[model samples]
Target: MEALLLRVVPGLSEEWQGATPDEIERIEQLAGRPLPPFYRWFLSRMGKSMGKLTYPGLDFSASRVLTCYAEKRITPEPRFLFIAYNSDETMPLHVFYDLEAPARADALVTWGDTWGNVLHEGFETLREMLAWGAVLSFRVGKMPQQCEGIITGEPVGFLSRFDSVMSRLGFTQPVPTGPYCRLYERPDAAMVCSSPSAATFKGGQAFTLGGVDEGALRRILGEIATEPSLEVEVDEWMPELG
Candidate 1:
């Protein structure tokens, strides 16, 4: 995990200041449960770093961790510990610690803040979780390089994998209702087309062009891609595709 953090966010190790053993003990006392071994090791290594990675809104400091746990200490079911949160503090990410496991190091299950539904599970250790996050971070452009070519250079397959990783990491956008033409306005002045059938919205770069026929959709997309002054009304009902 530390190695991955260094690779993804360079100079993270130097910036990190781990918590003292006494601080860790105090945190445990407050939480009324022993910290997982992998998590404790993580805290002992880099718990004080203010660096933000993966989730842009979160810091991995011990204080932040303790605060999140305290905030959710009253919630019931699927007992877990909060690890990180989104920018608005609406979503919290957590890890389920198995009390019965040997040293509580058997496996780690992660989840988002959607009523305790599991986001990911069966990670052998916290290191595995970090490793997965590293790959996912790369996919989402949070990390340095483009992960598209790392695995397979094919755009379609790479995009599929990218969406899969985002889903696993609980990065999802609200699906527009009825019919919509989703557009991806690219940096190179190219427009990408996406719809319910296409499902090509990548990394949240899409806007709803609600209820348009194929021709109108193409015209509006082209106008938006090139000229900023053009405006068009979208129909509420989607035309049937032959």
Candidate 2:
């Protein structure tokens, strides 16, 4: 999985650093639990890079995860250890590790933004979660709410330019949204556009773009390619339902 991500995502593995024995012991002491072997290996091999994804990665760092756990304990029962958060922290994913059975691999779980309902569960291990590719799928599925806009006036040659740009970036082909518009999606994000003047993009909650011209559209994609968390504010709007 690590090798695949490095090859396909580019720059994702540049900051990876193994955790020290002292760091590992500190986290186990902090959580009052023994870490699962695979998970412990991951921390020791790739903890730093986990949170540096184009989309938000798990808060795998010992200090940050411990801090979040502390914060959550004020109101709710901290039964689960938060492992990752969506780009804006609207959705946090967790794991129910058996503190008593420290070596056991457990399921990954999550709740909606309200934390009142379970959004997902049953991922049996960290490897299973990554292998399933649920992270990207979840991000894409939630994108419509994060950023959306309509292009009022069609701009000339927009579709072709959009296709050329996205295809060059190795994104899947655009899916038709309407006669004049199409939606292009990748594992990490999605975009909808019609002609030269308007488009909407959702990389994550903090990363969005909307109502831009062709020049701006190109620039925004370029910036996103470089830094997926790049944010530009535009008037908030939701996609019109059928």
- For each candidate, C-alpha RMSD in Å? 13.7, 13.5
Per-prediction TM-score, please? 0.44, 0.40
| lDDT scores in order | 0.43, 0.44
Candidate 1, RMSD to the unseen true structure: 13.7
lDDT of 1 by residue, 163-188 (tens): 44334433332221111121121221
Q: Which is the leading candidate under TM-score?
A: 1
Clashing pairs in 2: 155-196
Candidate 2 achieves a global lDDT of 0.44
Off by over 4 Å in 2: 51-54, 70-79, 85-122, 134-242
**Model 1 poorest ten-residue lDDT run:** 143-152
Candidate 1 regions with alpha-carbon error over 4 angstroms? 1-9, 30-33, 50-54, 71-78, 89-106, 114-124, 135-242
In model 1, the clashing pairs are none
Best by lDDT: 2
In angstroms, give how far residue 147 of model 1 lies from its true place.
6.0
